[model samples]
Target: MMGSERSRMLYERAHGLMPGGVSSPVRASEPFPLFIKGGKGATLFDVDGNRYSDYCLAYGPLILGHAHPRVVEALRKQAGEGTLYGAPTELEVEMASLISSLYPSMPMMRFVSSGTEATMHALRLARGFTGRSKIIKIEGAFHGAHDSVLVKAGSGAATHGTPDSLGVPEEVARNTLLAPYNDLDAVERLMREQGGQIAALIVEPVLGNIGPVLPREGYLQGLRELTSRHDLLLIFDEVITGFRLAMGGAQEYYGVRPDITVLGKIAGGGLPIGIFGASEEIMSWVSPLGKVYQAGTFNGNPMSMTAGLETLRELREKGHEGLFHNGERMRKGLQNVLDDLGLGYKVQGIGPMYQLFLGREEVWDRAGAMRSDATLFKRLYQGLLHEGVYIPPSQFETCFLSTAHSQADIDRALGSYEKVLRGLRP
Candidate 1:
C-alpha cells in the first residue's frame, strides 16, 4: 500500500476487464501485482522507489537483467534504421546465423513472436515432415497456450487426451498423446503401442514449468533412442532453458540434440522473439520451400533482433563462465542454508534456473514435483517478498537468475532464505 500506487491503480482498473488483473496468471501476486517503475542490473524499483533484488528475472527473458547497456544501445541504434520491414532483412539473417552456429542441431531456423508461436509452428512442421497426425507430449510440461498441445492425459494410460482447456475440441486433443516426464518406460510403452501414428515427441528436456526437475541421468539419451527407433521427431521445448543454461541451451547442456528446438524468453533480450530450428532436412518442410505454413507480422522485428543479437554477442564474448559460476554459488549457498536449518526440502533446477521444492525427496516428474509441500513454498514466497528478495509466486514455477545478479544480491537472498526457513519451523 505504501509503495504500490501505480500498480494498485492499474490493477483496480484491470479487474473490470482482465480475468485476474494481470496479463498472465503467474504475474498475479498476493494482495496485487507489484508495479515496477524501473530496473537496473538485478534490482527493480517500484513506483514508490522501493528496491527489490529480482529473482523472477522477468520470467527468464532478462538473462542479462533489466536495461542492459548493450541491449539498450543496440535497440536504440536499430530504431533509427526502422522497426519492421514487412520483409526479410540482414539483421534477421545474422540472428539466424548466430543461432545456427551455436545450435548445431539447427541448420535452419524460423523466427516467431512468442514461444507459443514457435511451438505451434514446430508441431505443424513436424506433422508435415513425418506425415503423422498424433504427437506425444509429457504431462504438465507447458509448450504454450496453444490448443493442440493443451491436451491432458486421460483417466488411464490407454485413453486419449481430453480437452485440458475450454473451447478446444476433443478432436484436436485426440491427436495428442500424453506421457509423464522422466518415465522412460512409460514413453517407450507409448511409442511401442502408438509409434505408427505419432508425429513427434515434444519435451522440455529440463522440465522447468512444473517446478525445476533435471533430466535423470541418461533420460535424454533414452528419449533420443526411443524417438529414433520409432522414427518420431523429437522436439525440445527449450524456451526457458535456451541461452539461460548455456550458448546452445539444453541441447548443448545435455549433449542430446533434439530434431527441432523451440526457443523463446531469452532470445529477445527482454523484447519479443521466439525461434524453432532443426536440420535443413527437417526444416525444409516449412514454407517458402514446402507446404507447412506459418508467418507473423512482427516475426523478425528489427528492434528485437538488434537487442537479441547484442545479447548473444555478450554471452559469446563472456562464454557464460560468470553466469554459471554465479548459479553454482547460489545453489551451494542455498543448500548450506537448508542443511543448517535441517529443513525437509530440496532445491532443484539446471544452471541459471532453479526452484526451492519443500519436498523431502528429489523431484523426478510432475507428480513428484506436485507432491512437494506447496504450503511451505507459499510461506517461503511471501516471506522472501516481504524481505525485498522476490522469487516466483508459485511453487510450480522456477526462479531465474541472470549474469546481472552479483555476490551482494545472492548473499542477500541467502540471508532471507535462512530467516524464512526459521519462520516456517514449528
Candidate 2:
C-alpha cells in the first residue's frame, strides 16, 4: 500500500544474487529495502522516485550531509589526477597533520581502509606494546568486525539477533573480555581477575552502536584511572562519534584522554577511511618503526584524504555550535512528542546522535536497550518511511543529525512522528 513497486521488483531480482538482498545485514528489511538512487544535502531519492529526509546519514559518516558541494568538488578534482598510487602522497601527510591538531591525543597515526582495519591494528598494537594477549571490550560497543572484537558486537550484529558470529574461533573469543557499558565495577572485576593478562580496554565513550547511550557522569575518567592502574592501554573507538560529537570526538567532549584513538566514518568525510593514532611512543610500536606489522595497499589513499581534508576544513571554519544546537532541538522535540502522546519510549543521545528506544523509559546499557519494543519500533519505522522521513531500519542502530538538516526538516519529521505515534496508540 505504501507504493514500492520498483523497490519490490529490484529486491526480488537481488535476493537471488546477494545474500538477503543487501550487502550489509542491517540494510535488510521485511518487505524490501528502498534502493537509493542518489542523495544531496539531507534528502535521498529512491529508485521509485520517492524523496525522504534522511536521518541515517549512511550509518553516521555524512556529518556535513550527503554530497556537500565542497567535498564533491574536491573528490572530482582529485579523481582527474588519479585515484590510488600504491605510494604515499602529500595528501596523507596533510590530512594526518590536520587530524593530529584536532585530536591532540594522537600525535602520530596510520591510515587504514575501514574502521574494522583500524581497530584490528589498534588491538594488535596494544598487545604488542604491552606484551599481553587479552583485551577488554564493552559488551555492546562495536569496535569492528575483526575476530578480536566481534564478541557481543552491536549494530548489524545486534539488529539481526546474532551478537556472536559463528565464524569467530572460540580461542579468539576467550581472550576478548566483556564488561557492561557505564559500569566501571565490571571492568574493575575483569582487571582484578586478570589485569596482567590484558593488554588494553577498548570502549566507545558514547556507546554509538547499540544505542547512542551517553556515558554516566565521570564514567570515562574512572576508566582512564582504572586502565592506568592496571597498566593496560585505553583505546577509544570513535568511529561513530569522531567529528559528529565534536571536532575532537568523545575524548575531548568527556575530557578523558585515551592512549589510542580509532576514528572513521566522518573522518573520511563519507569516504572509506580508518585511522589509528596515539602518542609517538605508542605509535612507534606499529610497523616500519617496530614489530606490530600492519600494512595496507590503500592506506591513506588520496581520494579519502581530499574528502576528509575538505570536510574537516568546512567544520573548522563553520564550527559545531549550530550542529549541537540542532541536536538538542531535535531530541527535545522528539521528547515533547512522546510526552504529549504519553508514550514511555525514551529519547537518548548527546551532541548530534540520538535514538528513540520504543517502549523503554531509560536505556543506559545494552541490556536496557534490548528491552525496548522492537516490534513497535518496526511499525514506527515503516510509518516514518511512508511519511517521507527515513531513519535507520533497526531499532538498535543510532540516528544522526547533520549540518545539512534544517529547522524545517526537524519540524516536519517531528510532525510525521506525532501523527504516526498517535495512530499507533492503543
Candidate 3:
C-alpha cells in the first residue's frame, strides 16, 4: 500500500489557504490528493516518496511528458535572456507561422494565457463579426470557465454536480445554446430556429472532457456543413486534443476545418498559453486592426514560445505514430482485461487520449457519459492510487499518453489496472 501521510498533512495545510485544498477543483480527491513533488518522463514522484506511472499528464498538457530535456533546456536558455517583453518578439512570428503550417485553417491567430481566454475571445470575435448575440455549444463540451459557456458545462463543473454555475446571470446563460454531441439533426433544428441570432457553434471535435467520446462517422463534416449553411462561425475547441491527436489537431486529423480554432495544452508545451485563429478577413476583426478587441500582457511570452517551439520540433522529428500505437496497445489491453473479468465497462479513446466508462453502455454523448457509475469510479481511483498509478481523479476527465511513456510503462500500467480491477470485481 502507498503511504500518504505527507499528502494528508499537506492537504490539511492547503485547505485553510485555498478552496478545496487545491488550485483547481478537479485536483480535489476524496481522502486527500497526492501532493506531487516532481515528475520525469511518464512517472510522477509524490511528496510521500511514492512513484506513480502517470496517465493524467497534468490534465492533458504534457504531450512530451514531464520535464522533457529539450523543452527544459530551451526554457532555461530563454530564462537567461528575458521572460517577458511588453512589445512583440520574433518568437511570436515564428511560433504563429509554424502553427499555421500545421493548422492551415488558422491563417492568423492571437495568443492568450489560457484556453478560457482563447475560447472567450473567439466567441467575442464571432459575435462581433456576425453581429449576433447568441452562440451554440455542445452539451458537456467544456470550452472554458467564462460565464457564457458555463451552462451545462463538463469537466470540474459536471464532476462537482454543478454544470451551470450560480454567478452567471440568466441573460448571459440564455445567449448560449446547448446541443448534444453526435446529434446533427438537433444542431440543424437549432440553426433553423435561431440561425440569424447565433454567432457561432463551438465544439470539441473528440469530446475530451466528457470521456474522450468520439464523434460519429461524418459528425464533424456534418457540423461544418450545418454551420456554413447557417452562416454561423464554427469554432473547434482543441484545448485537450490539440497537438496530442495530431500535429494539425482534430481539424486536420478529421479533414474538417473550423472557421476559428482554439488551441492550448500542448501548443504551449506545458506552459500557460492559448491561441485562437481564423482566416485573414475574420482575424482582422481583432485588436487595433479590427473591432473585436483582444489583448493580453503575457500574450506570446518568450518562455512559452521557446518551450513550445522546442516541443514542436521534437514532435516533428519523433512523429506521433509511436504514441498512436501505444494508445491502441493500452486500449486493447484494457478491453481484454474487462472481457476476461466479465466486466462490462466501456473503453473509449482516439490517438493518445482515452477513458474507461464504468458501465456496459458505450458513451456517445453527455447523457451517455453521465450514465457511468461515479461511485465505482471513486473506488477504482483509490485502487489505482494504492497500486502506484495515477489518472485524473474525476471520471469526466480524459487520460493521456505522452511520448515519454514507454512500452514497459504501458505494460506496468496494464498490470496495475488488471490487479486493481480484479479486486474491485464483486
TM-score of each: 0.97, 0.96, 0.97
Residue pairs clashing in model 3 are none
Collision pairs in model 1: none
TM-score of 3: 0.97
lDDT string, candidate 2, 270-305, tens digits:
889999999999999888999999999889999999
Q: Listing every candidate in turn, what is its Cα RMSD in Å to the true structure after a full C-alpha superposition? A: 1.6, 2.9, 2.7
- 10 residues in a row with least lDDT, candidate 2: 154-163
Which tens-of-lDDT digit does each residue in 1-426 have in candidate 1?
Answer: 155678788788887889888788888876787877899989988876678899998888998889999899888888888888898899999999999988999989999899999999999999999999999989879988898888755575236788888898878888888888888998899899989999999999888887878888999999999999999999999999898778998889889999999999889898888899999998888888889998889998888888889988887887778877778888888988989988767887768877888888999988888788777777788788778887888989988888889888898889998988888953
The C-alpha stretches of model 3 lying farther than 4 A from their native spots are 153-163
Clashes of each: 0, 0, 0
Query: Among all windows of ten consecutive residues in candidate 3, which has the lowest summed lDDT?
Result: 154-163
The CA lDDT at 30 in model 3 is 94
Residue-level lDDT of model 3, residues 30-55, one tens digit each, is 98889999999999999989999999
Q: What TM-score does structure 2 among the candidates reach?
A: 0.96
